[model samples]
Target: MGRVAGKVALVTGGGSGLGAADSELLAQEGATVIVTDVRLEAAQAVADRIGGAAVAMALDVASEAAWQQVIGDIEARFGRLDILINNAGVVVMADCEDTTLEQFRWVNAIMTDGVFLGCKYAIPLMNKGDGGSIVNMSSTGALLGYPIFFAYSAAKGAVRSMTKSIAIMCQDKGYKIRCNSVHPGAIETPMVQEASGRAGQAQAVPDGVLPAGAVGAPSDVAAMVLYLASDESRFVTGAEFVVDNGLTIRP
Candidate 1:
């Protein structure tokens, strides 16, 4: 227990799926977690489940004002921020040829722009304390192009790139902040399930997506976030951690 004892963490999209798992585990490890999601009720549910170690807040990641308000509230209440997990995202399936500019912009607004805003606002606050860990949830799609999820892949790719840039900037400036991105593949989450259904596939693997005999759970990704959020990975920054069960590897 107490893997992140006394730390303060803000997890965007903490209402459900991998975000919920991360929030619960971080609290179990003794961190005061702020679970923020656009869906206030869902975030509240997560906080209620975590008891005293968590609080639910409403945050529209695409809005800079919302980000400022939430961060300000965290500073006032917690006095310092030690961890920021930019996990809020959406996956929309549309071929490159069919995706409209509006669609692309919207996807990037949430996945790409949201992370940028979070980092921009949270960095100075994090620097105020002992510095902090920033974990951005990229996907295997970021490493490779998925024809059906073109915009999602593109946005996540930007996230992967931006994470490295932030990591190096912090390192160069001598800040103790460590920034990293996580690439998850075919996890059994609602978002993945929705994409699978849209692709006319069952919940089970559709051949080439997930490797044979490979399966993933929210806890799989959450465990990696826990390590990154903790002091155990102090030397790690500008790195990509793949929790995709070798799905990105080709024979």
Candidate 2:
């Protein structure tokens, strides 16, 4: 419960899925959390669950002005930023010839651009304090391609590569920020369930099918977030932590 005590963390898309999980876990660990989402009600609900230490804000990741305001507000209220989790993303499946321009831009805007702006705003704020951590949500698709995840995979790949790019840049520029991306293959969450259901994909593995003999809960990812958000990973950055059940390694 103490891995991230006395810190302040902001999670974009904190209303649901991985973002909500990260926000909840961080708050449980004693960090003041800022839960931002496009859905004000959803964000407020999460913030309520986290109690007084957490607050909700409505935000659209694509707006630079809104981002500046959010950053400024956080700085004024929290006094310092300790962690920024760029965990907001969306996936739309369409093949190359059939993919629409709007779909492509929509995915990239939320996934890639949002991640880029997160690091952009967070790096300097983190430097204001001793240092901080930034964890971007990528996917196993970042390392490999899937026909159905054309846009999602492409954006995630960019996120993985961009993590390295900015990590090196921060190191060179002398900011004490460590940026990495987590690649999750499959997990049982509302978002995953809904996506698969809509696609008519097979249900997740039957219970006990995992190599570890258990499906991953959001806590698994939250554990990684705790490590990245703490000094425990002070020397680790610019890396991809693949959290799949060896799915990416299989032939």
Candidate 3:
């Protein structure tokens, strides 16, 4: 049951959806979880639910200054940061032709740049102890050509590549850090629910998009995160773990 006991985890976007689930699950496994989101009140609510095992903080993932401040606070408070989950992301559903420069930049800033900053800052703190694990949340869009989500797919593609780069760099530099990306497809989150409405569909995954029933829950992804954060995946790095209900392999 104690998958990550005594670890210190910081989950960006920990206010709702997958982030809230990740925070709660991490705390349940005996880790001190720092829940950070742009929505301070929502973050606080998640933390309160986790009781003494968690704390809430405000973070705008696109800001380098905020990243620095939070990492510093983690070092000061926990003395060691064992896990960093760069799960903060936004999806702009517009095809390549219709997407604007602003939309493209905004998505990349949060999904790509945010993950970069988290790894850049958290590595040193992780190195202080036994090294740490960094989990970047990508999407099935990163692996496929989803015409409906041009910008999101592009940003998540960058995240996937960056994860591999970080993993190799750490290996070469003799840091014990492990970096990997998680790609989830059609998960049951507010984001997906919104997407469903916009796409004029009853379910987030269209009938033929997946081989069979394909929607999943936040806890499904959290279980994978826990394994990555724990010592169980010590040798697993530079990998893309897909929790897509076989959607990627279909057709």
Candidate 4:
């Protein structure tokens, strides 16, 4: 318990799925959590349930003004920011040939631009206090080509690369903030469920397709996120950790 005792974490998109799991885990570990999402009511609900030491805020990851506001609020309320989980993302799948400019820009704005803004704004807060950890959520699609998800893949790929750039920049600037990205493959979340249902298929990860036998739960990804957000990975940075249940390397 208390793996991150005395720390404060800001989890974007904390209203649902993996973000919700991450927020709950961080609170359980004795860290004050800020559950931020574009959905204010959803964020409030999660924060209220976590109780003890949690707050809710409307954090639109794609907005620079919102980012600034959240950072300032964290500073005023928590005195310092220790962890920034850049988990807010959106995936609008369209074939490259079918991809519209609006569709492409929308996904990239949130997935890639949001990560850039988070790291850019959070680094100063982390540098001001003890060095903090920033965990950006990418996907296995970023590493592998999924013909159905052209824009999402591109945005996530950009997120992965952006993570590396942030890591190198932090090292050069002597900022103690460590940046890394998480690549989850076919995790069981509302989004994935929606995808599967849209496919009208009962199975998400079939036996031969996924070595794990089934899709992973949000908690499966939360465990890894906690480790990254905690001091356990004090020296890890610029690395992309894949929690795909062997989907990435399965034959």
Candidate 5:
């Protein structure tokens, strides 16, 4: 049951959707979780529900100051960080021709820049102990062309590339930290529901076996996150894991 026993993990956007699921699973496996989100109350709610060594903090990923503050707090409180999940993101529903510069920059700042900062700051802390793992949440959009999610696709693409670079760097430098990216397609999360115009509607899929292009559950992606966060993936690094119900392979 203790897949990540005694580890100290930090999850960005731990308030809801995939983030909440990740935090819950990590804690279930015996890790002390720090849940951070732009919304303090949301993060706090998740933390309270989980209850234990889990705590909540407000963090604006795009701001260096906020990152510094959260990391500093972690250093002061826990003294070591074992897992970092860069999962916070925002999407703008606009194609290339219609997307404004502001929209593009906003999405990239949160997803792209946020992942960069998380890795940059968390590595040194992880290096302090037995190295750790970093999981960046990319999307199928990064692999396939997503015209309607222009900025999101761009940001996720950057995340995918950056994950590989960070993994290689850590390896070359003799660091034990491993970095990987996850590409999830059409997960049934609040963000996806709202973006797809099904926010308040029920989504039905087959029980035991999902169809080729059915939307997946948050647990599907969280399972991958759990594996990456655990020592079970000790030999895995610089890899891309896709949990899209085979949607990316359809002709």
Candidate 6:
């Protein structure tokens, strides 16, 4: 049952949806989880429910100072970091022609810049002991043409590319750390629900974008995260794991 036993794992956006599921699952499998979100109460609520070694903290991923503080705190308390889930993100439902510069910057700041900062700061700590795994949450949006999610797609694309770069760099340096990207499609998460609600639909994708019965649950994605976080995936790095239920392969 202890897939990640004795490990310390940090999840960004751990307050709700996919983040909450990831935190709960990781804790259940034996990691001391740090659940961080911009919403303090929400992150704390998730941590409280998970109990055990789970803790919650407020973190604005867009801020370098916040990243520094959280990583420093983790190092002080845990003495080693083992896993990182860079899953904080925001979606703007604006097409390229209609997206404002501010909106684009905001989405990239959280999703793209956030992942960069998490890896930049956490890697040294991870190196201090045994190197660990970094899972950057990308999306099907990064691989497909979603005109309405212009900024989100761009940010996720950056995440996908960055993951590969980090993976290779660590490999070359002989660090034990591994980096990978996860691409989820139309998962039933709060972010997807809100984006769908804005589009006046029951699901985030248009009727034909997702194949029939292809919608996924948060556990589906969390399972993938678990594998990546565990030693089971030790040989896996710089890879894109798609949890889209075959949606990415549709003709």
Which one wins on lDDT? 5
Q: What lDDT tens digits, residue by residue, belong to model 1 across residues 1-251?
A: 99999999999999988999999999999999999999999999999999999999999999999999999999999899999999999977898999999999999999999999999999999999999899999999988768999999999999999999999999999999999999998777778767767433335434444555476888889999999999999999999999888777866
Candidate 4: which stretches are off by over 4 Å?
198-213
Write one digit per residue (lDDT tens) for candidate 5, span 78-196: 99999999999999999999999999999999999999999999999999989999999999999998899999999999999999999999999999999999999988888988998
Which regions of candidate 1 fall more than 4 Å away from where they truly are? 198-213
lDDT of 2 by residue, 1-251 (tens): 78889999999999987888899999998899999998989999999998998999987887777788899999998889999999888878677777788999999999899988888887888899978899998988888768887888889999999999988998998988889889987766666766667443434446443675245667678788878888889999999999888877778
Candidate models: Cα lDDT each: 0.93, 0.85, 0.91, 0.89, 0.95, 0.94
Cand. 4 TM to true fold: 0.94
Q: Write the per-residue lDDT of candidate 3 for residues 36-107, one digit (tens) a residue.
A: 998999999999999999999999898999999999999898899999999998888799999999999999
lDDT of 4 by residue, 1-251 (tens): 99999998999999988999999999999899999999999999999999978999998899999999999988887789999999987877679999999999998888888888988888898889998899999999998989888999998999899999999898998888888999998877777877767442334433343445468878788999999999999889999999998888877
Better of 1 and 5 by lDDT: 5
Name model 6 segments beyond 4 Å from true.
Answer: 198-213
Ranking by lDDT: 5, 6, 1, 3, 4, 2
Q: If scored against the real structure, what TM-score would every candidate get? A: 0.94, 0.93, 0.94, 0.94, 0.97, 0.94
- The best candidate in terms of TM-score: 5
List pairs with backbone clashes in candidate 1. none
Clashes of 2: 0
Model 6 residue 200 lDDT?
Answer: 28
**Candidate 4, 20: how far from true, in Å?**
0.4
lDDT at position 20, candidate 2: 85
State residue 43's C-alpha deviation in candidate 3, in Å: 0.8
Better of 2 and 5 by lDDT: 5
- The residue pairs found clashing in candidate 4 are none
Instruction: Please list all clashing residue pairs in model 3, or write none if there are none.
Output: none
